[model samples]
Target chain A: MDLWVTEYQTPSLGFSCKISETLRVEQTKYQHLAVVNTDQFGKMLLLDGMIQTTEVDEFVYHEMITMVAINSHPNPKNVLIIGGGDGGTLREVVHHPLVENGTLVEIDDRVIQASKDFFPQLSLSFNNPKANVIVDDGIKFVKQHKDKFDVVIIDSTEPVGPAIQLFSKEFYTDVYNCLKADGIIIAQSESPFFNKDVIKMAYSGINNVFNTTKLYLASIPTYPSGLWSFTIGSKKHDPEKVVFSGDLDLKYYTSAIHQAAFMLPNFVKNIIT
Target chain B: MDLWVTEYQTPSLGFSCKISETLRVEQTKYQHLAVVNTDQFGKMLLLDGMIQTTEVDEFVYHEMITMVAINSHPNPKNVLIIGGGDGGTLREVVHHPLVENGTLVEIDDRVIQASKDFFPQLSLSFNNPKANVIVDDGIKFVKQHKDKFDVVIIDSTEPVGPAIQLFSKEFYTDVYNCLKADGIIIAQSESPFFNKDVIKMAYSGINNVFNTTKLYLASIPTYPSGLWSFTIGSKKHDPEKVVFSGDLDLKYYTSAIHQAAFMLPNFVKNIIT
Candidate 1:
């Protein structure tokens, strides 16, 4: 089939690149990796049927996922990240003033190593002394820990292969157990477009345990759909209340955007509802 | 050569999809127009080498671009859109209660016709009686008109091709002339990641013509970097003061986001400074 590509830029998608040639694909222990350079977004990397990163914009995703959950929790003392081996999430999490301790539990040691070697800016979050890099299964770690975290951020890959367990009800239940009473958790639920069923399932699963469940949206160029959704589960504090009250120093998430992010499109809303 | 795809979710980039397909040569017009159906974003369309849209997530882009610019302008009586023939911008433009006349100047009638046929929800904006669809070059139209618009939104394609003139100094000057003293113009710049140079250039270009120039960011899934940037140029109004005081109820843009949208990143700040 002669496939034609079209890029929607109304809202102004950041990086738009069209690839014209075969670059290179590297099969990693965790996922198959591929590298392609396009005319728009620059160098992009794909892993195990999912996009990992490109040389273009990387700040939006990392900031929203970390800031929303961290900022929502008034006192984020200890932070646990599940499967953010890229360290980008960790980097943003450490920026929070209240976060004293941060732990990244990733299943693939290679992902972390690869990110550190290749994408240095993303891996920069690990430079902080408080960030504890744990090369262990995030699910296993969550099972052992109980009420130890004030905030938990799930930066898992797609709901396939090793990352599939992160979307399970049992895992989220454990995640609920692993947080403090007033804790908050943000999970990178797949693109609201392609992964509607998965997002709905995850939201339903997380909603079963949490007091409040909110879905936030972000646009990632590398993802299957430009529109990406993140589900934030809070226990005590409401997302609406954790307003952007501080110095107002943010590139992505502002008080207005925080509220807007919660406003899901009708289709996504229908799926989750 | 073998091509590899990788997706990265950055702070500026909400999400990205990388494709690593083997290729022989790159086409000029459709370098980014490779369509791929994935487990996530549905039938993805690429053009000239960037993501256009899938059946999903088009609302996010439309809502964001139109809402922000429309809400920013106070009492937008006569609105002028430079590009955006798909009618997504027009749809959002006419939503303003005070918007008495809305004119869309698009070079590609095909895009408008195609969108009206393929994406009905987006094209619905043009169906309104208030909308005046002008199938002509936006650059020439703006140049011919003087002090004719309250708000001018440049929803053109990328800075390349037919839309390239919209980003030039002369076009911005014409846009400045076409608006009233208190007029506002919002232009879609490139991603801050890959298109920072272009964004910087456009920033400098717009700033040359308008007094109060602000660079804001948005996330759309179908774009290259997923981290979209919009530059707003005002003759007299401050974008920070731009609010949704109008009676039109909006799903996205709000007073808070309007103020927050002007908050520039350190990198962006460095360039503007």
Candidate 2:
């Protein structure tokens, strides 16, 4: 018998992985969550039938989301992560020695509980002395805080269910208010091949809210198309020109990769704007 | 009531596309061939249950394989493409204004016929006045002709069945002998994520015979990991230093991208060597 869990990346496309065992499954207040052990990718996490993160290639997504923004700012002291219950974004955020404090805002506590139980390697960052985890909606939390964060990272899921409001101009405007001057924000844009319209909307929406906006790319094999895009909105600094001064011994993020990620393919460039 | 064609990218991973219809399927003299019309990706061709090329993303593969070499060589008059039965490589090769003649040696005529019938956009270049289509084993064709070509492009399938010999050191040695002095050669090295061993072997094998060998990357949505790598073995010209001179209106490759393709992520750089 074959035990395979498949995600319909689109109505006409599917990506599957052979699972060794079903570790856990339950319906949280937000969405349906599942954690499974796979043959190739170790532990896997899924929400609403969409892959959220996997143990193997999760570093690529996490590094691109956090380190790029952390390195973009001259002195990143306070960092906020929105909707990253797996704690992977926080794990990458704390890598910068200049970060004095980090906060994570995730509405679903069950996801945090499940990840803490299943993915210890990623969830261990929650116990860091400088880290704070909160159970609240990200938009509401950001609206209450003004000029508090040096960098704000949105590590949410695809824009279908709870994440739909997160991609709007109002939400980005709120995030723009919560960040200090010269602060930068990075959000996960969907795949350009499978989610062209969403990516375009993201590109347009971010550009309207921030003074300087740029888009970058990374490869996440467990995602819809294995090609994922990220959008960065900066208030004053340009991510492309920011020099790297951090001493994070990273495995994926490099000074060259930071510049290379923003160089879009022509097909993607046509769709992104 | 629904039929889907799936490629087991590995023993534990599968990527599937919904097919409107199966246009044709046959066991040719070389390998199994199947052409299906996909809902989103248009037409896709498969060999031995692995995706050889898709109508949508074939341009990215073909352009990177040929234009990079054509632009690398200062003056490329004679070119050879091995095992590119679909003529997509030849299609991109003929775009160069400097090419005087091009030859495509394929072991199987059925794949060419199928491409001509199904993928007219890709196979139309077979009728170019400058192209010579020959159905023969490419290894023997290269061995018999030495110091005969300016650039050699190996556009074969993965290392399996009849095409496995094309990845050997002996094959690279023969290809080295068949090129003009200061000639260049490029071949498809599989994904660094899934086919790490194969890419490592190709890198070491090519470096042993050529003075400057480099590996580059592109994102193809239909492939195993969407991240694909290519190996270039040059006699004297460093592909990195050689600037792109062509003026073709391509949708993916750019002058900056030509240099940026070689700027790999740290993980892939570690794997290629």
* Local distance difference test values of all predictions, in order: 0.71, 0.89
Candidate 2 per-residue C-alpha lDDT over A172-258 given as tens digits, one digit per residue, 9 for 90 to 100: 999999999988989999998889888887889989999998888888878876789999999998888655665677778887888
**Candidate 1, residues B157-186: lDDT per residue as tens digits?**
676666677778988998999999889888
Candidate 2 at residue B15, lDDT?
91
For candidate 2, the share of real interface contacts preserved is 0.77
- Looking at model 2 chain B, report the run of 10 residues with the lowest lDDT sum: B240-249
Give candidate 1's whole-model lDDT. Answer: 0.71
Model 2, B129-179: lDDT tens digits are: 989999999999999998989899999899987788999999999999999
Candidate 1 per-residue lDDT over residues A1-273, each given as its tens digit: 221122322222223345654366567677776655654455555566456665555677788888888777778899999987888889887877778999999887777776776677788878798889999988999999999999999998778777888888899999999999998888988776556788887898899989999887876655654568898888999965664367546666665566656655455667777
Candidate 1 residue-wise lDDT at B4? 28
Who wins the DockQ comparison? 2
Candidate 1 wrongly placed segments (more than 4 Å): A1-47, A53-60, A90-100, A112-135, A238-273, B1-62, B107-128, B135-137, B240-271
